[model samples]
Target: MTRTILTEAGAQTAPSGDALWLSAADALRITGWELKPEGMCRGELCVPLPAGMAKDGQIDLAAFWGHIGAPLAHDAGGTVWSLGTAASERRQSLETLEAPDFTLPDLAGAAHSLSDLRGKKTLLVTWASW
Candidate 1:
């Protein structure tokens, strides 16, 4: 059986094993990272995994997530899990302190650019009835 993991990026299914381990490939698919000899790498970034986190070709998912300061939550039945954004990403967002520029349309269908509000005190509010 496989466990379904829900992440902010999307959902992925990882092979199930004991209580703590997940296949390296499955873990990578869910986390966008691979456990290399150097470390857990995604693109050009690599964060070294502590000793014993990887064993017998599988990763200790809980320990790996904890080491990177990413939170994980599972349902009571252990059939589903949620992985939160890594601490590094959150730290980078805080360091930059700049919101990504985006464009959205108004009720009349006129598009507005966030950059247009630069240097002005703007209060942007959005609501959904759902």
Candidate 2:
């Protein structure tokens, strides 16, 4: 059977016959990381998996995510699963409530610093013509 796995990035279909485990390939596609001999790897980042996270070559989705402190939820029927942002991301957001200061050019090429508007209530709108 297939289950719908939802993440902040988007959703994807994953093979989940038991609704609790996902094949290595399916899990990799859904999570953007692959379980390897070294660990779970994405690009150059590798997070070592705790022992027993992978069994019979299938990953216990819930346990794997939980091990990394990522939040996950599943529907009552287990047909849909949602993966929340990593705990580290959430912690970073909460730690810094203020937007980072940056400089950007205006229509006429005049640069403006976000810090300059710190004392005033400002509404900034940005658009891209693409």
Cα TM-score per model: 0.70, 0.65
The C-alpha lDDT values of all candidates are: 0.81, 0.82
User: How would you encode candidate 2's per-residue C-alpha lDDT over 1-117 as one tens digit per residue?
Assistant: 678999865788876578658888888888877889988887897888887788787888788788778899999999899998787977798789777567877789998899999
Name the best candidate (by TM-score): 1
Global fold similarity of model 2 (TM-score): 0.65
Worst lDDT 10-window in candidate 1: 11-20
Counted clashes in each candidate structure: 0, 0
Predicted structure 1: lDDT = 0.81
**Deviation (Å) of 127 in candidate 1:** 1.0
Off by over 4 Å in 1: 97-125
Clashing pairs in 1: none
RMSD each, Å: 5.0, 8.5
- Model 2 lDDT, residue 128, Cα: 88
TM-score of candidate 1 on Cα atoms, chains taken together: 0.70
